[model samples]
Target chain A: MSVTPALDARREFESLLEPVATVAYRVAYNFTRNAEDAMDLVQDSTVAAFRSFDTFQKGSNFRAWFLRILTNRFYKSRKRGRVETTPIDEAEDVFLYRQAARAGLLGNDDDPARLVLDRFDVEAVEAALDRLPDEFRDAAVMYFLNDFSYDQIADVLGVPVGTVRSRLHRGRKILQRALWDVAKQRGLVHGDGPEGAGA
Target chain B: MGTARRAPVPKDMSCAEVFARVQEYLDRELNPDEVEAVKAHLDYCPPCARGFVFEESVFETVRLKLAASACPEDLMARLRECLEACDES
Candidate 1:
């Protein structure tokens, strides 16, 4: 049948994408934060992937390959939506930092990350992540969600590795502050009447 | 603030140096000695320790949350149909 090659192509595409579709969709969803846009993004990327399947090297990681396409689509659409801008939370940042310090949370030997892990739940994590600016959040999300290495994230985002590092660093600080707030609200930790009024 | 506490960082490691490398250290990209330096600094430096803990926990949180998530079935179906169109075209 004339359709055999096309069917074979479709089959090949399906086989490659099926396993990672959920992840691909999730990545797109992370980018768009809207299911409909995410769906469109993934669908469009899928079509693009199929169209260019011939270029994909066999035995290469399909997740990275397809996701590179998916992310490119997202980046293209968002070029107009949000430009790279600096974070404007200096006052709030100092407040959060001092709060964590004042709460006797900073100097302790206890795992600060554990407070978030054991006390807060997934929703809180998502909320905290939602508050990050797009530049930092995308790298952070991709790093955490897909277990992408710094190098892979850099490659996918098409930026320098240093940029990925900075985003993760900044993103982690924002999330740490968010998690500290969560702990305080739950009374998981409380103020210890300040840490000698120091930094 | 950090300038005062960092006076005795062994091997000239400053608080800024230790904290700055937290992400790379956690990522295991640091050299063995660098990792030891961070661990050493974390022992006495609560701020960096706490920050490290928070960052570590962030990794754990993501792993936990992603463990339970799945793609909606209809989206998967929709994706397949989208590919089917490629077959026709």
Candidate 2:
């Protein structure tokens, strides 16, 4: 049996790719918000990654390196132009904590974060994540889903570290607001007024 | 109840300043000095500490919830097949 350079490359690529395949699929799903499209994206990205496998530096971060390719494929295949910005609001930075404080839920008896988490099942939390603008959602997913550092996220998103910081800052605020609205609609928490108002 | 003696407020960092960097603190983006500054403030202020805990808990909850999604078997199979095909061509 001849072990050619091509065969060696294939084995190495497979070994590296298998571990990250699940994460790649999830990232694609977050991008497409559809299973079939996500599959296509993952497939396309995997094939592309293999063809250029030699370029991947050894002993480097394989996940971030592969995700850079996957994210590029996602951006290129898009017919719709990416939305780079969301309108900045005068919203409080820690909106949920503030809301919980005003509603008297931050006392010794009540853990506001636990209250929100207990009320929102995984599906509800994911739905709230889906409601964020694409840029914010992508940043939040990259950071929260895989524990990617801000610098790693910047490398994957192809932005400056500062941009990643701002996106996460805004993304957390937006996610909190969405969670608050969903909880209100479901009557999970009783508030004296709407989200921003004192309860 | 006896009045509790709190550590004097950190001179370099105010509550507002600590709050502003709270997200970075949670995300571990702050450098050591910045983190120490934020920690100093949180040590003295119970309200600020509670706020930080709430933010951290929310982030941890979301992380665990989102990571619970498993990649479907069919997608994994197709991905494997694509790799095999790449080897052939």
Candidate 3:
């Protein structure tokens, strides 16, 4: 019966992971657009999580812990492959808000967010998210899509909470631009050229 | 005539300041004082308020939709297998 504790530990991990597995995979897939790579990431991170189970606090946020492992592994692998040192995009935040305002899209009493939301479906949102650079895209997906709190995102990304805040701020601005362009291409909004040139 | 309470300075948290921190506000990352300041600005600023609504909706609508999506069935099976292997090992 020496294996009983280990077995129980495994079972507990599995049970905890069950509910978050899909989300974990989704997060991984968003990190790596390929399915196989995503699966490998999930498995690798899950196995890592299993090994580090003892360090995990039982009552605390297991999902965040596991996702931290997943994201750490991902960043580590990228480091091993090649070092990418791009500066964070520090462009004006709320690109869409400005664009909408210029296009008179925000002039109406209509819900601007709803107006934006109605223009694009999930796939379009995903596409727009995918277009973001690695740093911003990861934060955007984790926060907006994966529902990670700023704390969890900071832990997962191995950055400070302030960095997470900036990344999300910039990421969202970039996403707004992406969404605006996509909507225009689809004719979802009329009048004014891209980036509000006409308006 | 009844005296009215003083109106907000309108300069307290200008539209620019509110816009700069709107994401934090929407994410509920602000402290009480900060939240109140942002709220005061939002109250008087219709355009900023509408922008806040729009920004909030973008995160919410997308989050809800993407959250409902599950991984592929085969991927789930593989992940389960992964757990089983780890358990046995």
Pick the winner on TM-score between candidates 1 and 2: 2
Candidate 2 DockQ category?
Answer: acceptable
lDDT of 2 by residue, A1-199 (tens): 8899988887788888888888888878777877778888889999999888889999998888888888778878872323343333424767888877777666674567887677787767777777688878888987886568888788777788888888888888888877766666677777743455322
Docking class of 1: acceptable
- Checking candidate 2 for backbone clashes, the offending pairs are none
Q: What are the per-residue Cα lDDT tens digits for candidate 2 across B1-89?
A: 11223234355887777887888888777777788888888888988998889988888887877777757877667877888888787
Q: In every candidate, how many clashes are there?
A: 2, 0, 1
- DockQ, every prediction: 0.33, 0.33, 0.29
Clashes of 3: 1
Sorted by lDDT (best first), the order is 2, 3, 1
Candidate 3 lDDT for residue A75: 83
Scoring model 3 with DockQ, what do you get? Answer: 0.29
Would you list the clashing residue pairs of candidate 3?
Answer: A113-B54
Model 3 chain B is weakest, by summed lDDT over 10 consecutive residues, at B1-10
Clashing pairs in 1: A113-B53, A113-B54
**Model 1 misplaced stretches (Cα beyond 4 Å):** A1-3, A79-115, A182-199, B1-16, B31-33, B39-54, B66-70
Residue B40's lDDT in candidate 2 = 84
Candidate 2: misplaced stretches above 4 Å?
A1-5, A79-90, A103-112, A192-199, B1-12
Sort every candidate by TM-score, greatest first. Answer: 2, 3, 1
